[model samples]
Target: MRTVAYYKGCLASLSAKELDISTQALAPKVGLELIELEAVTCCGAGDIHEAEPDYYLHLNARILAYAEETGADTLMTVCNVCTLNLRQANHALQGDPALLERVNRNLTKVGVPAYSGGVEVMHFLWLVAAGEGYELLKGAAHRGLKGLKIAPFYGCQILRPSKLLGFEDPDRPSSLERIIEACGGEAIDYPAKIKCCGFPIIQAREETALAELIQPIEQAKEAGADAMVTPCPLCHLSLDAWQSKLKAQTGKDFQLPILHLSQLVGVAAGLADSELKFKRHVVSVAPVTDKLAV
Candidate 1:
């Protein structure tokens, strides 16, 4: 088994720490070792990409530099946003030597060292499915989710309008649902599977964010999605954040649980309740947990 360094980005290491815990827990069953970074920093996620582009590239690139220092070629991450940002930085560095030089200069200013485009960055899901083959998926899966009407929702960054991490097709993505069914999950047809959850405007425009969120939830509900599964942490916050507010404003009634791909995969892994930290979620997974216990 090769040692795979996990670049548990700033958000996951700090606020969304469960994401780190969840994905690390997942790797062992898949015959992979998720080596933790000795020193990690923010990928300069969303805002940096637009505002401070040069510093952003160097910071994320330093992570790649760290991985290369270990002689490891693959860097895995759980955050879709971080993965995108870092991948964007790496891709830019490889193509434009001028931009790479500038970013390296900025990196030195931050004391993160130089980034030389030495490592490949990946999302943990993509990494697992590739490393383990579908068989480990078969082995880890124990839950009979055969009857579950799941909407395999891919948030904007993960699947995308195209470009970043071309591990799988962007427009007609099936990787998530493919793994879902392999683990005995039943896939549902939801219209808004590719729609953005309006995560970009959340801080600036809260009401718009909620309104944007309603679209996916409504579409999933309309298509009879028993639960919505996503790989993006920001997307989780959007869909699950203002549940009551959405209900009150739209007068739409339903209790839908937004699950991280790790959470859903954990269930398929047949993880014991003791192993899965189901309580860390701001959104309740009780309805699903109740069924699991019975």
Candidate 2:
């Protein structure tokens, strides 16, 4: 069995437990041995870097250290922000001796081993969609999303700063689209395919944030997307959790059900709606579930 350390970031641990639930429940089916990192903490998600750069560096380094302790070759994250935070920290620490020393010093303060960049940080999407190969994912597909139109939401983390992230062509990402197609679904193409979900600036720029959230959703609805699928829990929340609020603000109903990539993959893998906790979503996933029932 191929082993990897699972890093369920802060949002998934609290706000979006369903992503964690579906990922754990679906990993085995996709031929991965997921080892959960219990000692792991928040990655700080780029926010702490602004004020306390050391905190961001140290927090992610500590998480990487824990993953190393698990003896796993890779640290797997389901959240885009977590992937960005951890990967950026890993890239920085490995290349900069001074930064690594500072971060390791902080980690040593808490009795954790200093990070030596031993483990690879990656998104779960890379493992299944790219690493394990689409054929493995397709072979695991007991049920097909034959008629489902899934709009792939990449968010920003995995795509931007393309040199460091290295997941896909930051200019145009087809990984998610390919995965959706491999699952037997139509991947809808839209203008906002690579746009930010505005979760990052909701506090500082609420109005602009709402507008950013509205763009892709409306585009997806216009493109005949049955649901929006994303890998980021924060993006999921920005799209699903804030739908009603956006509807009220814009006087337009965008009741599109936002799905975590795992949930969508689980559905394609023939898992039941109950198994993936569809009801946990604020937006009713009835459209997608009803299609699955057929």
Candidate 3:
């Protein structure tokens, strides 16, 4: 078993609980022994990165401190924002001695071990698809998602800043598509596959965010997608939860069922709907599950 520290961010711990559940269910099948980091706090997602830059250093370093104590060689999270926050912080502390000293100074006062740049941080999707390899997952596909047409949604943060994350070609990432194909599903190619999910500005620019969110849904529908899958919890929220609201706003009813990549993997791995918490979703996933009989 490949041991690693699992960081469940604010969204995964609360709103997107199913992402956490499905991830835990699918980990063992992928040969990952996830070590939960309890003491780790928020990664200062969203506005905090701009409003309070030092807070990310202080909090993320402390989170890494816990991961270091666990002796796990890797630290992983499912949320794209969390992954970006932690990964950027890890890179920053590793490169700049001044920032590391300042962060360590904060850690010492809290009785937490200072981060020594020991653990490598990765998004769960990258860790599984790139690190574990798509073939390993394909070999484990027992109940597989054959005959299902799926569109892969690559949200912004995890892929961008390619030099930092180093997971895939940001312009043309096929890891998610490959993983879907490995799970025995048909991965559809669409124009908006690489488009933004419009999650970040949802609160500030609601109308603009709605337009951005609906663009992918309509494109996926046009491409004959049975469902859309994403690795980011923020994208999941925008694509799954706000889907109908976007319909109401645009007067075009594109009821595209959105799912987390982990949930899709769980189903292909033979996990039941209850195990994946399908009922927790705002938009009914029946459109997606009904086609599962295919």
TM-score per candidate, in order? Answer: 0.91, 0.96, 0.96
Per-model C-alpha lDDT, please? 0.75, 0.88, 0.85
In model 1, which regions exceed 4 Å deviation? 105-113
Q: Candidate 2 deviates by what RMSD?
A: 1.3
| Total clashes for model 1 | 0
**lDDT ranking of the models:** 2, 3, 1
Give stretches of model 3 more than 4 Å off: 131-133
Model 2, 6-76: lDDT tens per residue? 99999879989889889988888878899999887888888887779877878888999999888898999
How many residue pairs clash in all the candidates, one count each?
0, 0, 0
TM-score of decoy 1: 0.91
Show pairs that collide, candidate 3.
Answer: none
Candidate 3 lDDT by residue in tens digits, 61-92: 99998999899989988988898888888999
